[model samples]
Structure formats: structure tokens, C-alpha cells
Target: MHSKIELIDMSKKNPGEPGIEIIESPEALAGQINKAEVFFLKNRKVVLGIGGAILVAIVGFAGYRFYIDGQEGTAQNALASVVYDFEADSLQKALNGAGGNEGLLSIADNYKGTDASNLASFYAGVALLKQGKYDDAISRLQSFSSSDLLIHARAQSLIGDAYLEKNQPAEAISYYQKAADYEKNEYFTPVYLMKLALAQEKANQPADAVASYKRVVDEFPLSSEVVNAKKYMGLLEGQVGK
Candidate 1:
């Protein structure tokens, strides 16, 4: 985006022109110090032009930062209103908006770079999931990024569920594995593991399916997943036996 300009002047004459020779560094010419001054002026002009470009770049960057900050503030306020509606169990109002307040979907669509906007995407995804709009939920949830391990894990698991409900066993298994391994928290791990086991079985990898279910029984014995894991494992083993 940034560039510098330079000029090179090399002058020479044909040797046939009365003992003429090549001239190197015209600035070093015997009696043309004045010409050298002109060359220096040209270099100065180029440097000044580069300096002006740099100044404009700095001003542009400052203005962009200001614009982004303003957008972030607006998005935060919009998201707050949506959250209030959501907490009141007014799901439609939270997602589609009401009166003067913008909803989570609107904020996510228009102010994607803001923190509140990112959270809006998550909220939108969860709302869609609750409404059984699985594909739409997956799109929004996958767009959200967060450092919160629990939320991230939940999103991954939800994606797995969506895929599973759609009968896409391979996709379901991938997302389930991501959810199961993401934060390694004891609470959600078994749930995701069971989902993965079911998905693997659907994918027809009976051995891998059994292994996944066995993990829940062995490593998460107290979890609710353990009961279903045992059942699923038994089913897979029986199929293999046949």
C-alpha cells in the first residue's frame, strides 16, 4: 500500500562522437554541480510525497477506530435490550425485536465486529435451536467465538445435535468430539461422549462406537451418560456378535 519513487539518470554518448565516453553518476559530472542540485530536489520531492501519504494513513486509521468504537457502543445497548426480553421469556421479542429496540439477530447482522454483536450471534443461535431451526442455529453458533469454555462446549454440542437430528452422522460425530474434548469439564463431557457414541454407531463404525460409549461408563461412571452408554455399548456389541 505504501511505496517510494526514485529516479536514475545515466547518460552516455557513442564512442564515435569525437572521443566520447560513458558518464557514470551524472551528479559527479565535472562541472554540473547545479544539475546535481536539481537531482537532490527531485529526491526531496519524492520523500515529501511519501511523508504526506503516511500522514493520510494515520488520519484514516484514527477515524476508523472512532467509528468502530461508536458501533460497539450501539451494539452493546441493542444487545442489552435483547437480553432483557430474553430473560423475560419473550423469545420472539428477543429475536425479532419489539418497538424501538433492535434484536439479537439485527445486532449480529449489522455490528459483527463488536463484543456484544458476537454474543448476539450466540443468542440468536440458541434461540433458533430452541425453535427447532437446526441449520440456522448451526450457522449462527459457528460464527460466534468466545473464551468461555462452557459456552463454547455447549455450542459445539448443539451443533452435534443439529447434525444428528438431520441424520448427518459423520458431521454429528465430528462436532460431538469437539464438544466432548473442548474444555474437558466433567459435567458436559459425558453428554458429548454419548452423542459421539450414537453418531459413530450411525456412521457404522461399530468398534469406534463401542469405544466411545465405553469411555463414558469408565471415565464418567456417575454421569447420566453412563446408563445410556452401557445400553448403547451392549447394543453395538450384540450387533458385532451377529
Candidate 2:
């Protein structure tokens, strides 16, 4: 009987087999390293330039942040000096400054990007409103922005007050609605809603006024403005019925 023997094929080992390994010769490995070195040398200038640019950008941003921090501190100090004038109702002195201290207008105009400058705009707006400069008040108030929920809503409400003083009930209604709707909560929403209803009434929108007032009464029953809202709503309902 003839015996049959099968030889293992080392060159054609299955690539997917678990234990299969391809070992590179020293010459092949050296050639790959040489190619990588050549590529790095060829693009050395480009790589260095990109790295330099990233370093410069990071340094420049850090410097800018440092400068802004210094400016904010200065602005807050300047703003603090004028707060007493504003609180005491010395509107002109607050707006224009007294002695050597900077005023609201200067802080707002000079500081520009600082938080104190933004607060100066708010204070200046209210000062202008008290002075009966409604247009100027609106301009300053519109320029002021805040992330504080209560303060931001108060700014919107103040703009409505400015428009109301200007005898523009339509404009007043729009701003009042914005105040009432912005970040609605129990503490301030009722006050804004009351203003909105008053603006609606001024604009001859009795139904809208009643609805706004009803919202204050129903949505914020515990609010200080709730009693006024209920009284206004009842009056509006009677007026609408007539």
C-alpha cells in the first residue's frame, strides 16, 4: 500500500488565522524608518510654522484675558463711585460724575466691554427716564443687556415704562409683553403681567388686558401683584361686558 503525506504551506498561511504573523526583515524596517525621516525633513518648515502659529494664538488669548480682567476691575471701581449719586436721586451728578470720579455715561462709553459699563447703561437709562428724556432712556436701556433673570426682565419692563411715558401704547405693549414672557417665574412675572395689562388697556385692547391680568391672578396667586391683577381683571371684564 502507498502512504500519502501532506506538506504544510508556510508561504500561503491563512491571513485570518489567529496565530499567523508576518515578521519584517531588518532591511525593510530600516527603509520604512528612512522614508518617515525623509518626509519629516521635507515638511520641516510647514510643521514648525503650524506649531508656532498655535503657540502664538494661545499666548495672545491668555494676554487678552488678563487685560480684560484688569479693565473689569478698574471699571467696577469707577462704577462704585457713582452708585451713591444714583441712589440719592442726584441724576445729573450720576450721569456726569462729581469731583474726580467717573460717571455713568463715561463708564458706559469708556469701559465698553466691561460688566460695569453694562450696568452703567442701565443706571443711565433710569436716570434719563427720571429726567423725562424718554427717547434717550430707551436708547440706553436698549443697549443694556444682562444674564441675571430679575435684572434682565426689569430692563425690559423699564423700556415699556419709557414707551408708556412717550405716549406710545403700541410700543409699550410690545416691551411689556417681552418682560412678562422672559424667564417667567412667580417673583417677577406677576409685576410684568400687570404692566402688560396696563399697556394693553392704554392701547384700547380690553380683552387682551383682561387676559394678561387673569394670567397674573391665576399663575401667581401668591405674588404681591396678584391682588391688583384680580381687581384690574374684574374691572376689564366689566368694561368688556358693557
Candidate 3:
């Protein structure tokens, strides 16, 4: 599943120290300035040392940001090159590049802190899942983190899908529930709720499955999933009653 790439803004300025003392007159202001000068003269060596360290820190931070920004661009380009393979269903080539292009795995491994690296994890996981490598898919998906609600919820749902493929319905239920509950909305929540219900049914929790399905029908009546949810809910409710 493709998602919008979101770049994290790390730029921030240090806030100035609070609580300024007011000077009632020019004399008082001059006196404060003189006292500051005298104090600086007394602590000249220490002040210079602290100032030098702060300057070094600022320069180092700026340089690191520049380096990471460049790395992020490179990683993004590499990722874009491989994503075509992914979209074309060339799962192997997508995961492990071909013909001089770096693959999703290489981008993820080579550029650790870049946003593209994080997105590579998601792409790699989906490719692994398509390849039927459930365990590896789970690991790759777990490594991904996103602040976007839709993407994060989709990742959780994909994890649930991997677990379900492995026949671990209980684990699938947990992740599906997480996906269903995360930033609940009409567009995605009902879909996740249906998955949660199916996983619950597979786990032999008839009552819980019924509840999950009923949520889709009642809470998301306008959703496309509601018809199927209602059908499943009726079936499970009858079983629960029996």
C-alpha cells in the first residue's frame, strides 16, 4: 500500500531565558552593564571556553543536519526507483534491486534515519508478505513508524494480515484491534473492524467477533463493509445464542 511521504521538521530555535529585570533609571542600567563587564573580565577564560564549546556544538549540529538532508534525498531517489518494481508486482526485484538500482532493502539498511528508509521498511514488508515470507514481513513492518494516522493504521493492519497468514489468529486480532481503534474514521476503521471480527472468529471468540461485526454495522452503517459485517454478525449472533 502506497502512502504519502511526510518529512519531519526538526528545525527549532532555543527559547531565550525568561524573567527580565526592569531598570528604573539610566544609572541602574549602566550599573548593571558595568557589573556584567566586571564579571566577564573576572571569568574571561571560563567564558571563552564555554562560548567556544557552544559554537562548536552549533556548527556540528548544522553540519549533521545538512548531511542527513542530503542522505534523505539520495534515499528518496533510490526508493522511487524501486517502488516502480513494487507497483509492477516485481516483488523480488523491488526487495533486492536489479541493473544498478538500489532496492528497498538497501535503502532501508543504508539510510537509517531518513524518511525514505522508514518508508522502505513498509514497502519491503509488503513485498515480503506478497512473497509469503510472513516472519520477515512482520519484522520489517514492525520496524516502520509513522505519525500519519492512515499510514500507521494501515501498517498495523498489514501486520495483522501477516499474523493471520501464519495462522496466529490471536496475534492477528491484537494488531487488527489496534488498527481499528487508531484514529477511528469512516474510511478505514470499518475495514479494520471487519478484519478484527474475522480474526476473532478464527480465534474461536464468537461473542467478541459478533461484537466487532456489530460495531461495523452499527457504528459505520454507511461504510461498504456494513453489508458483509451485518451478515457475519447475524451468523455469529446465532452461534452465540446457540
- Top candidate by lDDT: 3
Global lDDT of model 3: 0.90
Per TM-score, the best of the predicted structures is 3
TM-score of 1: 0.73
Q: Give one clash count per candidate, in the order shown.
A: 0, 0, 0
Worst 10 residues of 2 by lDDT: 1-10
lDDT of 2 by residue, 104-148 (tens): 999999988789999999999999999999999999999999988
Q: State candidate 3's TM-score.
A: 0.78
Ranking by lDDT: 3, 2, 1
User: Stretches of candidate 3 above 4 Å error?
Assistant: 1-22, 25-53
- TM-score of the candidate numbered 2? 0.76
Where does candidate 3 clash, by residue pair?
none
List lDDT for all candidates, in order.
0.84, 0.89, 0.90
